[model samples]
Target: MSSAQSSMQLSNVSDPLRVHVPPNETPEERKRRIAAEKKAKKISEAIDKQLKAERDEMEKTRGTKLLLLGSSESGKTTVLKQLKIIHGKGLENEREQYRHIVHLNVLTAIKALAKGFEVNNLTLENSENDEHLAAILSLSSIKESLNRQSLSLQAAVGGLKSADDATAILLANYESVKAVWSDSAVQKYFESANDIGLQDSAKYFLDNVDRLAQENYLPTDEDILQARIRTLGVTEHKFDINSTTYKIYDVGGHRSQRQYWAPYFDDVNAIIFMAAVSAFDQPLEEDLRINRMRDSLDLFNTICNHPLFKNTSIILFLNKIDILKKKLNRLQLKTYFKEYQGANDFQSVTKFFRREFLSRNKVVDKNVYVHFTHATDTTQMRVIVASVNDMIQRENLKASGLI
Candidate 1:
């Protein structure tokens, strides 16, 4: 191992970070800390003075929260990135605030974790050929990305969402330097849903993020790294979501991860259910989209039926339609809602899901509808995302008599 790794293993801050104290200070120097604290407090107030206090109450997200819950890789994070660009400056503080409240602390722990790691780390299952790169994410690393929070775009879905789910997903994948990873030993040895300890670790990690920032050692580099990515990888531009600003909660679509979706429903206000077009019939190796959709839909049924989410507004996004550009037809999609255009191809597959899955329980009381697009190909995904956003906003309006 490199010196860095060796130093890191020994560097775990088992206790809280140390206070920055000057060397060989006399009793009189203790007052220096008081002065310093006052000065720092003044600086913070001055910087924030430019921003208005009723910021949250001024625009769309103030009253309503939107959650992006769907199968993994459904482009929820990408959509939030799009919103950051569209609402730039206007929602800059909101985005930063969300990141601050959500992702700050464990970022420190992740740094500590990565410090102990060496490049080219890998683990074997049965043989060297079966080995793979070490998993980088940990429950502790998720920080504020989980936990209960007030609301944002994700609130539009249901209360189950915490921060922007989509944003958190991409943040986890950002440059190795910007974000930290779980030590290979920890990831391989202890990370699992069944590992009840992870739940506590997740809670503890969030508490630190909240506590550290409250003490003003916040807006750290990793926090800024997440903020810098606020507008990263988004494709939507014309989508006029509620007041043109949104906080989207993204959900994992994998079978193993689906169970995590339930706890987020308590506070969400809106929902975007993503269905990937390209994932429909692809083999598992080709993509997990198909299974993710089926699993997600089943989960959606669970969410909608939940007493708290029964009245929530939900918009269904048919993500990844670009992959089917050569194969798709509007007329064909219309057939999905019809009795028989020979329910085949994309329409048939989706129709079967809707009819079987959504109709089975039938508890959803708020507006619910499906639209299609490819999340990656902006040309098509743009329309789908926009349509979903607009539709959900309209539902909110109709319910509130705002329109």
Candidate 2:
């Protein structure tokens, strides 16, 4: 996976994924299938026995955390949904594939945590009781959570700017409450105040998530908690051949939650940075759309120097080419951009990426490959998954001293 050839692979003429050997009797079809079986066997040997340790190390140490960072509604969720289909099943059932597709619902997690706040924030018209104090604290805590740039989560509740200030200024600022606890009692009571509202709405939120998780039946608290636990392990994907399962840490792309992005690099053995070609054309300064690309570059720069990812085999996916397929020219994207600050030319965008995100011809950059992918189309989707699996195969080969 550490070679530029890591991104290249043999694929069938009819398909960008599979290939088969020429059959002695059959002209095309049987020939292809036979070749496929042989290729699958070779790839499998390369993966299971040769590169098993590297892949296993990925399982054990650094989960090549596939960070799908893009602003909300930028089709990041759609990308994830598409991946689940590939992983849940298989592109074409290749015997050698090792990539595990996992999806993290960061927005859903934020919404659930927010619901706890919304429930707490609703102060009743006639309530001044002790129970209400808890609600107020909950409200304050939630507000803080909503306002956070990201949640590494030090103390969810406890810090006070001085007990006297907690009632006023500190409580009002979401950041202040975030500093302490988003689950504090006093914060909930205030947030639940009839004036602030949302107590009734929280029930609906919980009910929906629970029902969905339970396969259309309402789930017990245990099920919801288990689901939550699953969401936290994906900072970067960790793998091990020693075990059947590996851990992955997924990164978030929300503008307000970007702060949580960098900390995950500490543990990753490999990195998959997802980007959109849209940024090259329709770059924007303020919009959420462009912020994803900008943030990816920002976060990648953070990972590049970080001890964990510096030499790690990193894959850069130019996701959502389906949208770009319709693109006409650089000039068309001018409207998408707020203003052409420096890169008014098409070459400038390329220059911008070179100066910013790329590692400037490091050995890692050579191994660091870019794969253009459209996750929705079955054909293209196969290509993308195969590309990643191929990278893993090469790594396995190198580990076994075969290449």
Candidate 3:
């Protein structure tokens, strides 16, 4: 064979067995060629080694990551708190932190009730309630001023101090709060507090005013779960279950805060989407023109059909079932959701919402597991969490071809 033909044949051979030598090469040139080949091989091996190390590191650090998403007041944070109580370290260390929040919840409830009375043009049952209303309103004004000032100062001062002062004021006028809340006219508005933008926890706090007014009260786990605070940014919580580390990300659910959600979507194993089923009669806190339930359905549809989350498991939490149960007797589901033709019972309403959410999955064959949950119920949440854990693990195994 000719020299060119031989060289081509040698080049096509496998790397380990192949040797390329020019037909008319000098001894010195041959030595240099060998040295060059040795150096190229070493560099290639080094690159392979580095890439393997990186892969190993990624595998070692990889864990199950769950993203919690929803509209405002949809119980996303409460679910997170429940996980902390059940699977992770309990909330004993954060009792004091929650104490102030719980106290603030009481004040917020009273203020909301006081405002509700005016909005509905209702009068107090007794003239004595006028003095009580004045005290509550005065305290509320002070709190609002402190809040505005704190915002102007970028919250550097007077935030926590204002909460503390409000708590003290609440304790001082404990009887007044009780008296105003007990007024028959105020109760009428309180019954429709959701329509007037009251927090879901207001009733719980208002009902427990006597216990909350105590000097040395620390919040119970249930109390902590009932507390409502708008999540401003993203929060990461880590816990271990069954020898697997779990990283749960709770991002703000407000429309403005949703811009921060995309970064967490890339590597998520599952998403727990919360929706307050009880909010059918309520409007969005951000935009009063839109009904809260309608907003949730639209948001869920977007997330459920997003291309990036095609392979990610979605766990839909129809949260606040307790509130829905209470509201059904007072507010008609068909009033807000005109398309809801089903009867206005808990089963019909919950199933209707569940179908609405599931129908949002435009992706072919995508399954969304639905759960009707009261996030503040610790026992019920424990069972749901376990079921979610098992489902995620099964999905992960299927993805890895290990099942």
RMSD of each: 28.5, 17.5, 7.9
Instruction: Score each candidate by Cα lDDT.
Output: 0.46, 0.42, 0.81
lDDT, residue 403, model 3: 96
Candidate 3: regions farther than 4 A off: 1-60, 140-162
Query: Candidate 1 has what TM-score?
Result: 0.41
What's the lDDT for residue 269 in model 3?
89
What would the per-residue lDDT of candidate 3 be over residues 149-209, giving only the tens digit for each residue?
0111112124446546656777888998899988888887677666555778777888998
What is the RMSD of candidate 2? 17.5
Question: Candidate 2, overall lDDT?
Answer: 0.42
Instruction: Please provide TM-scores, in order, for all candidate models, with all chains considered together.
Output: 0.41, 0.40, 0.82
lDDT for model 1 comes to 0.46
* Angstrom error at residue 129, model 2: 50
Model 3: colliding residue pairs: none
lDDT score, candidate 3, position 134: 80
lDDT of 2 by residue, 303-337 (tens): 55555555567666666554454343324444444
Top candidate by TM-score: 3
Number of clashes found in candidate 1: 34
lDDT by residue for model 1 over 275-386, one digit each (tens)? 6554433322114333444555566677667677777867766665554443354234433235335545665655665565456357735567766644434455546656
In what order do the candidates fall by TM-score, top score first?
3, 1, 2
